[model samples]
Target: MRAVVYDGPFKVSVKQVQQPKIQHPNDVIVKVTSTAICGSDLHMYEGRTAATPGIVFGHENMGVIQEVGAGVSKLKVGDRVVMPFNVGCGHCQNCEEQKSAFCTEVNPGFAGGAYGYVAMGPYMGGQAQFLRVPFADFNALKLPPGREHESDFVLLADIFPTGWHGVSLSGFQPGESIVVFGGGPVGLMAAYSAVLRGASEVYVVDRIKERLDKAKSIGAIPINFDDGDAVEQIIRRRKGKEVDRAVDAVGYQAVEKGGNTEKPNAVLESLVRVVRPTGGVGIPGLYVPSDPGAPDEAAKKGHLMFPFGKFFEKGLTMGTGQCNVKKYNRYLRDMIISGRAKPSFVVSHEIKLDEAPVAYEKFDKRVEGYTKVVIHPND
Candidate 1:
């Protein structure tokens, strides 16, 4: 078996590894068919998060069940399934509350568990020839018949619903205005979700023309932050005022004029500057308070220099953290199946398992026209 192994900052290698086997009575062994690299995986590749070296580097995955343990009854050896990024024990209190991302019974030290992500649980990543899924009966979403193209649903593991979660947190009403910072996959999906939710206007701010073009293709107003102040651009369009809802999809280490800054404050700063005074803000971007390789002492505290006074003065509300995938995955799946949504629009690259090394390099560098990359382990 082969898997994408994390070597170091801006490094990943496709190497032969021992195939995973069923280790628990409740487990199922899946022969991974399709897996996708996520922005979160970039955090591990860059060594910004706490990803362990040698672990596989994928989480957005779908596959065919090759074997099942004695206790795994609902799923069989030939079932097709989509594995959510977060692994949860169905009996946990948080799982019962639909907060599967913070399952109390699995990986208790953290909010939840995920495959091949930093600061997540001990689960091995899914970007391999095979993977062992614990609590398989509860964790895998059985795909409907005739759904051969599971690549689109692969986004269900994280980014698809995560983008929707960002929009949901904003509490944006129909005919309202919204702005999303960052034009990466998540930001693009967030803009798409806003359009589905009846937002009259959606503005996406980013320096990249390629991503901005994608935003425009999805009917979002593209604001080139590189041309001028993004806030001023939005204000000028909104008649000298900010929009109703603002979202920050760019987390730590945001792009700056000369280079990237290790500051979570940049996203918040943009939100405060572009959101209407009484409106809300949605922050789905990643933020770690402590990092072993932080660039500065202030960054070590995970605190960004935010304008809290302005946030308070304007009475703006905020929602942040990892999205609980279980809460909306089933519904989002239905949307895809029913032709109401299409997540594959953001997939910019798809390659075989062996091509991960090249894909990682280009994606980590934000190479032109590379937004999301999907890997087929069996390709």
Candidate 2:
């Protein structure tokens, strides 16, 4: 078996590794068909997160079940499934509250667990030949017959559901305006989700040309912050009308528009400044409680100096957390199946597992047209 193993900051390698086996009576071992290098993975790749060396690095995954444990009656061998990043015990109080992202049991003493992530749990990632999925029946989402849209279906594992969660967190009402910061995969999907949900208009702010273009292709108004203050640009473009809701899709590593300075809280500050009075904001971007790679001492301890006063002054409400992916995936999957959505439009590259290391560098550098990268282990 081969897996993308994290070596250190800005390093990864596809190396032969042990094949996974079912560990729990309710577990299933999946032959991974597709996996992705999530933007969040960059935090670990850059040594920002506590991702230790020798760990497999992928989380977004969909696969065919190769073996199933006896207790997993809802799924069986050969069933095509996609899994949310977070691992949850179906009956936990948090899972019962539809907050599987914070499920208590999988990562003891921690709020949640995600496959292959630094602070999540001990579960290896799916960027390998096989993965052991715990609580299989409850965690794995079965795809429709014939695997109609494998590329599109692959997104249901993370970004699609996570993007939809960002929109929902923003209190996005149909016909309301939304401005999403960052045009990366999740941000692009956030704009796409906003469009599908009937946002009167979606504004996506980013400095990258390719990302901005992709956002435009999805019927979103692309606002290039490189041209000027993104908040002012959006407001000016809307003829002085502020957005009703905003989403911070760029977190921790956010840079200033058209510059190299690390202003991690840039998007959050802009969102507070641009969202209309009494409007809402959502942050689905990854923010760590402790970032050893922070550019400053204060930030290293997770103390960002964003404009909380502005958010307070505007009477705005905010929602921030990891996306409870399972809570929204089922409904979003139906949208994909119904032809009402195609989150796959954001995928710009499909590479083999062996090419993951190179793709990681390009994506981390925001290479032009490297909007998203999907890894096909079988390729």
Q: Candidate 1: what lDDT?
A: 0.85
lDDT scores in order = 0.85, 0.90
lDDT of 2 by residue, 1-379 (tens): 9999999999999999988888889999999989988999988898887778999988899999999998999998989999999999999999999999999999999999999998798899999999999999999999975657888988988898888889989999999999999899999988999998899989999889999899999899998877889888888888999999999899888898665988877887888888999999999998888987788999999999978787788899888899898998888888888988888898999999988999999998987577789999986
* Best of the candidates, TM-score: 2
How many pairs of residues collide in each model? 1, 0
List where candidate 1 sits over 4 angstroms from the true fold. Answer: 258-262, 292-295
User: Quick one: RMSD of model 2?
Assistant: 1.0
**What lDDT tens digits, residue by residue, belong to model 1 across residues 122-160?**
778888988888899889998875445577788888898
Query: What's the TM-score of every candidate structure?
Result: 0.96, 0.98
